[model samples]
Target chain A: SQTIHQWPATLVQPVGSPLSLECTVEGTSNPNLYWYRQAAGRGLQLLFYSIGIDQISSEVPQNLSASRPQDRQFILSSKKLLLSDSGFYLCAWSVQSYTEAFFGQGTRLTVV
Target chain B: TQLLEQSPQFLSIQEGENLTVYCNSSSVFSSLQWYRQEPGEGPVLLVTVVTGGEVKKLKRLTFQFGDARKDSSLHITAAQPGDTGLYLCAGKNGSSNTGKLIFGQGTTLQVKP
Candidate 1:
């Protein structure tokens, strides 16, 4: 079965600090990857998605950026974190154009 | 702007009670999906409705797609405590939209003993 992994299950960061969240899939190659931010008691907002290596699309203009450094690896990064950037970050992967996307464990970042 | 609007942002009921949550959209969708998410976890797919006017049931949960493909509903019969979670409805509009999803503000459900 395919599984997705994300690092730093939880983090407490200071405002203006750098942020990097990593997501990797062990069983799939060339999968469509997505990054989403979910605030407490709120809905998931699409931040970015990548169809292939180095192909990234931004849905909402935010401090966050995403990259597909490897076929099975996706990274979400920020040069400087804002308190507004604090939220639950989720990474998902799908196989085809229109299919089910499996989600990783998710990273909860709380900016103080 | 939120493309999909979910009704009853919060709901609390006793076990064995029945309830329905709605997801409405102005734009037409090719497919609509329902998901259940527990606290501190990612949403899990419950069901997907593709055909217009289609209805699919999973145990106590019944999912319905609008005939015009603009909305969907989830009905739960004889709910249980295990059903307590956040329910989210998402969809992809026709060919113009790929796999990208427009999600509804989730409805948080609490079922007590």
Candidate 2:
């Protein structure tokens, strides 16, 4: 079975610091990747998605950016993190854009 | 932009009780999906409703889509503590079924034993 992996299960960063969250998929090649964020006990908001290597589409303009350097590796980065950047960041992958996406364990970020 | 409005943002009930969560919208969709997420895990696919007014059942869970293709609902029969989680509904954004989904606000269900 295919699985998605995310790093830094928990993170605490000060304001104006940099941020990086990595997500990778194993056992699946050329899968569609996505990034989603959710506030505590709230709904999920689409942040970014990638179709293939070097192809990234951002939905919300914020202090975050995404990049797909490899077929199954996606990285979310930010040079300067804002207080609003604090949330649960999730990474997901699907067989294609329209299919059911498999999600990773997620990264919990807290900015002070 | 497509927006999904889910009702009953939070529900706390006893085990064995029946409940329903609704997802409504003015925009029509080609497909709608149901997902359940635990406290710290990712959302797991429960079922997907495609045709208008379509109904699908999964053991104790029943899912239905609106006839207008603009809404959906999830009904649980004799809910259990194991069914406690955040329920979310998602659908194809627009004409293209090959794009990111627009997710509902989600319903947080808490079933006590």
Candidate 3:
């Protein structure tokens, strides 16, 4: 079975600080990875998706960026955090296009 | 960009009651998925409907995809407290094969015990 692991299940950071969230998938190779953010009581918004290593497509433009350093490792980073960056960040993986996506436990980020 | 719209942003019902939530879109989708999300956790896939006019049942949940592949609905029979969560509908963009998904605003369902 494939599993996705996300670090720092919960994070609290001061404004203007740097943010780094990591997601790694085990038991799957060359899987499609995605980054999504969900606001309080709101639906998720896709931030970035990668098809392969070093290839990322961003859905929305904001203070965050994504990188696929390895086939199973994906990272979301921000040079400087903003108050609006506070939300629940989720990492998901899928075997192929138009398939069901499996998600990680997620990380709750609060930028104070 | 493809857009999915879900109705009844918030629903509160008692256990054993029946309720239905609708997801509609103007653009056709190659596939559609429904997810249930609990508080503090990621959304989990409940069901996926691929074919037009497809109907899938999972326990007490019945999901239907429109014949035109542009809409879908979820019907719960005799809902239980465990069914309370945020329901999200996502569609695979027809123009993209990279697995890009467009999500609806979501419907928050609360089944009181």
Candidate with top TM-score is 3
Q: lDDT tens string, model 3, B1-113?
A: 67899999999999999999999999999899999999999999999999999999999999999999999999999999999999999999777878878889999999999
Which ranges in model 1 have alpha carbons more than 4 Å from their true place?
Answer: none
TM-score of each: 0.97, 0.96, 0.98
**Model 3: residues >4 Å from true position, as ranges?**
none
- Model 3 is docked with a DockQ of 0.78
- Any idea what lDDT model 1 has? 0.89
**How do the candidates rank by TM-score, highest first?**
3, 1, 2
Candidate 2 residue lDDT tens string, A9-53: 999999999999999999988888999999887778989988889
Model 3 chain B poorest ten-residue lDDT run: B93-102
- Give lDDT tens digits, candidate 2, residues B1-113: 78999999999999999999999999998889999998777888899888998999999999999999999999999999999999999988658645577899999999999
Query: What DockQ, on C-alphas, does every prediction get?
Result: 0.61, 0.67, 0.78
Pick the DockQ winner: 3
Better of 2 and 3 by TM-score: 3
Considering only chain A, what is the TM-score of each predicted structure?
Answer: 0.96, 0.97, 0.97
